[model samples]
Target: MAEAGEGRYEIASVISRSFETVRSNLGLFAGLALILSGVPAFALNLWQTSFGVNLNAAQPDFSALLSAAYLGPLFVGWLVAMVTNAVLQASLTRATVTHLSGEKPVFAQCLTVGVSMILPMIGIGILLALGVGLAMLLLIVPGIILWLCWSVVVPVYVQEKVGVIEAFGRSMALTEGSRWRIFLTMLLVLVGLWLLSIPVGLLTVAVAATGSVIAVSLVTAIVSALGSMVMVTVQSCVYVELRNVKEGVAPADLEAIFA
Candidate 1:
C-alpha cells in the first residue's frame, strides 16, 4: 500500500509538470480539434440516409447503418486526434521556448508538424485500438497497461522528433517508471470527460425533442471535441515535462527546432 501510494505521488508530480507545458499553449488545440471533428461531423451529415439517423429512434435500421458507418471519417477521428497532439506538442514546444527564451514561433511552423505526422498518427490509432482490444480480451488490466504506454507516443514523436517505432519506444520507456500512475491519470481524464458530458448530452436531447437532432449532435460533437482538445493538451504538456526531466533539454532548444 505504501509503495502504491508513493507511486501515485510520483505520477501526479510528473503530470503536474506536464500540465505546466500544456497551459502555455492551450490555444493551438482549438482549431485542430474543431477541424478534425468538423470534417467527420460533416461527412456523417453528407451520408444521412444510412448513418445519420439516431439508433434509439423507433424505426432505426441499426445493423446496416452500423456496418456502413464503421469505415467513415468518424473512425478517422482518432487519427485526427493523434495528429492534433503532434500539432499541439509542436505548439507547446514553441510556446515553451518563447516563455523560457523570448523566441516566438509562427503558425505555419505549427501546421507543418501536424501535417507531417499523418501516418504515425493513424498508426497510433490502430495500435491504441489493438491495445485496448487485447486488454479487454485479457481481463482489462493488460489493455490499460498498453494504453498508458502508448498514450504519450505522440509527444515523443513531436518533442523527440522520432519515427513511429521510436516514439513508441520513448513512450514505453517513460511508462517504465510508473505504469499505474499513468493509468490512474488517464482513467481520471476519461471518466471526468464522460461525467461532464452527461449534462451537455442531456441538454442536446432536450433540444432535439423540439427539432433538429443533427444540430443537437453537432453541439454534442463540439463538446466532445473540446474534451478531446483538453485531453491532448494535458497529454502534450505532460510529454514536455517528461522529456525535459528525461533528456535535460531545455524547452527553448526544442522550440528552436520544432517551432
Candidate 2:
C-alpha cells in the first residue's frame, strides 16, 4: 500500500500520461475509434441527414421526424451504437492498461477482451446512468458528487474482474480522498474537448447548410471518434493513477491481473 503522504496523484501527470499514451499508440487507438465509433456515428448521421430535416430552420418538421421511417432506423442505429461504444470502452481500457504496464497492446487481445466484457459493461452503464440521472433529478450537486465518485467504475471492473456493485464500491473507495482532484481533472478535459469542437461544430453547421449530408456526417463522425478516444484514454489513466496513489500498485503489477 502507499505510505502516508508518499504518493500524491497529480492532475497534470494524468493528463500528460493520457496524451502520451494516445500519441504513442495513435494508429491503434485511432483505428479502434474509427471502426467502433466513427462508422456507426457516420451511418446514423447520414441516415438522419438524408431525411432532410432542417434543424436550423425557424420551425422544423416534427411530423416527418416522428414518422415510422425516421424513428425505426434511428432506434436501431442507436442500439447498435450503444453496443459498439461499450465494446470500444472495454477495448480502449484494455489497451491503456497494457500500455501502462510497459507492454505493447495487441489489437486482437484488446478486441477479444472488449467483446467478452460487452454485456457486463452495458449493464453497468445502464445502472450508472439511471443512478446518476435520478440523483440529478434530486439535486445537481448530488449528481455531480455521484458522478465523481463513480468515475472510475469502468476501469475498476475491467482491471479487477469485480461484480457490478463491488466495482462501484471500489471506485468510491479509490476516489474517497481525491474526488475533488478527479472532478477538476475531468472538468478540464471536458472543457478542452468542448473548445476543440467549436471549429468542427462551425464547419458542420456550414456543411449542413450547403445540403451536403456526406460531408457533414464525415466531419461529425471524425470529431466524435477522436473525442471518444481521448476521453477513454484519460479515464484509464485516471484509474491507473488512482491505484498508484492509493494502493501503491504499479502498472506492471496490474498486468499480473491479466496473467
Candidate 3:
C-alpha cells in the first residue's frame, strides 16, 4: 500500500512537470494526420464527380446518391479514427508524461489506451449514427445536439477505461468543468485545419483522373490521419489532467503509473 501510494505521487508529479512536451509532440503527429485525412474523402468525392461526368454528360445530378455513397464510408472511417484516436492520444499523453519524467512507454501503449475506449466509442458511433439517421427523418438540430453532447465520449472511455455506460457518465462529468474550453478549442482548430486543407481539397476533382489526384490523395490522407491523431493526443493530455483532478494523486503518483 505504501509503495502504491508513493507510485501515484510519482505519477502525479511527473504529469505536473511534463505539460509542455505533451503539447509539442501531439501537435507534430496530429498535423501530419490531418493532412492525410483529406485523401480517401477526396478520392471518393472525385470518383463521384467522375461518375457524374460519365452518367449523362448534362451536368447530371447525383448529389443525393453521392452523399449516401461517399459519406457513409467516410463516417465509418471517421468513427474508427475517433475510437482509435482516444487510445492513441491517451498513449501519446502518457508517453510524453513518462518521457518528461525520464521513463519509457511503448509506442503500443497508445493502442491499449485506444482499445479500452472501444465500447464507449462504439456507443458514441451508434448514437451519432442514430442521430444522423433521425436527422434524415427530422431536421438536423437534434442530431447536432446529441453529437455535441457526446463529443467527449472517446476521451471518457480512454482516460477512465470505462465501458460505454460509464463512459457516457464520465464524458458528461469531465466535460462539465472543461467542455466549453475544449469545444471552443476544437472549433478553432477545425476551422484552421479546414483553411489549411482548402488548397488540397480543391485539387481533388481538378486533378481527378490524373496520377496527381492519387498522389495528392495519399498525401492528404496521411496528413489528415496525423492531424486526427494529434488532436486526440492533445485531448488525451487534457483528459489525464482531468483524471488526476478526480483521482487526487500527488506529483509522484503519476510517475509511478507511467513507470
Candidate 4:
C-alpha cells in the first residue's frame, strides 16, 4: 500500500496495490458496483430476456429483433447502461483518490463527487469514444494507438479537474515515456478479468440451461459489476502511479486537491 503512493511503481506493484484496495474496501467497491453496474446490467438483461431478443447477436434476426417492441427496451437499456457507466467512472475515480490519500471514503461524499464530475466525464468519454471509433474506421492500429495514448484521460480529468481538451494533453504527457508500460498494464488487467469471468461464464451457462431468465440475468449482472469494479480500481491506481513517476506529484498534493 505504501508503494502505491510513492516514487515509482512497477507493473506488479500497481496491480498488487489495486487488489489490496479492493480487498480492504470490499463493501465500498461492491456497493458502488451494485449501484453503477449491477442494477443497469440486470435491467438490460431482464429486458432482453423478456423481449426474447439478443441485441448483441452477431447476426441478429432482424425480422423480429427490429420491431418496436424490441427497440424500445433496447434503447432504454442502452441509455441506462451509458448513464450508469459514467456515474461509475466518476464514483470510482473519486473513491480511489480518497482511498489512496489514506482517508475513509464516505459513500455519500463519493456520490457527490461523481455527480459533480458526471457531465465533463461523460463528455470527454463521448469525445474519446468518437475519436477512437473514427480511428478504427480509418485503420485498426490507429484506433488501438489512440486508445493507449488516451488511457489515463479519465483519471487526469477527475484528479486535475481539467477541461476535456487539457485532460487529453495531460494524459498524453503523463503517458509519454510509459505508453508501453501502460499497454502491458492494460493487457494484464484484461487477462485477469478474462480469467475472473470464466467461473461466471460457466455459471451463466448453467443458469441459462435451466431456462430461468431472472437467474441468468442476476448472475451475469453480478459478474459484470465485479469486473467493472476491479478494472476501475486498477485504472485509478495506474493513473496515480503514472502521475507520481512522470511529474513527481506527491501523495500529499493529491490529498490536498480534495482538502
Give the best candidate by lDDT: 2
Write the residue-wise lDDT of candidate 2 on 1-259 in tens digits: 3347757879998999999999989999999999999999999989987888888899999998899999999999999998999999999999999999999998899989999999999998898999999999999999999998899999989989999899999998998888888889999999999998998889888987997779989999999999999999999999999998888898889988646
Clashes of each: 3, 0, 40, 0
The sequence of per-residue lDDT tens digits that candidate 1 reaches over residues 155-188 is 7776667787888888987656656656676677
Error of 2 at 104 (Å): 0.5
Residue 235 displacement (Å), model 4: 1.3
Off by over 4 Å in 1: 1-27, 45-54, 57-59, 62-106, 245-253, 256-259
TM-score of 1: 0.73
In model 2, the runs with Cα more than 4 Å from the true position are: 1-6
Q: What's the TM-score of each model vs. the native? A: 0.73, 0.94, 0.57, 0.91
Tens digits of per-residue lDDT, candidate 3, 12-118, equal: 33233433554545553444334334444455544544443345556655675467666686677666555554444445555544544455545555446545555
Candidate 2, lDDT over the whole model = 0.91
Model 1 misses residue 220 by how many Å? 1.9
User: lDDT for model 1, on a 0 to 1 scale?
Assistant: 0.61
Cα lDDT of model 4 by residue, 6-35, tens digit: 345479877887888888889998999998
Ranking, TM-score, top scorer first = 2, 4, 1, 3
* Cand. 3 Cα-lDDT: 0.52
* Order by lDDT, highest first: 2, 4, 1, 3
